[model samples]
Target: MSTLTPGEQAVMSRFDLGWPESDIAADLSISFARTRAIISTFDSNPAHDRHREAQIRRGSQRLLARLRKAGGHR
Candidate 1:
């Protein structure tokens, strides 16, 4: 796994919540330009991309399981 700075982690977490880059930047007290740079940095790293994808998939699966257990389905 790639080591992320706390700020980067905060950006990624905000992304997971579906926040726009501008909003994430604002919330993190960073500029939009910096946010774009951060995203570009993340995109350039294969290991980080794979790790993030795995984490997202795992979270989705867990949410699905919980929803199923609660008798919710599409």
Candidate 2:
């Protein structure tokens, strides 16, 4: 895959790190509405949607790893 932009990387990283959308928006200095709009645009395109799904899957894996490391759950 192509390298993501810094902003996209930040968004992906925040999501991968288990930050909520509101928190991500706050950290990125963006409004929640803008965040929602971005997500909507990502979802609306088939290719982008697939890419986002992969990102989410990767994020979920990272979250699971953190949980395991913390002995939180299975």
Top-TM-score candidate index: 1
Tally clashes: model 1: 0
Q: What tens-digit string does per-residue lDDT give for candidate 1 at 1-74?
A: 68999988888778777799999998889999988777756655688788777988999999999999999956
Badly placed stretches (over 4 Å) of model 2 are: 37-74
Candidate 2 structure quality by residue, lDDT tens digits, 1-74: 56667876777677666688899899999888876655545333688788778999999999999999999975
lDDT of 1: 0.83
Cα RMSD, each candidate: 11.4, 13.1
Using lDDT, give the best candidate's number: 1
Scored against the true structure, residue 74 in model 1 reaches a CA lDDT of 66
Per-candidate local distance difference test: 0.83, 0.76
After TM-score superposition, the amount by which residue 36's alpha carbon in candidate 1 deviates from its true location, in angstroms, is 1.1
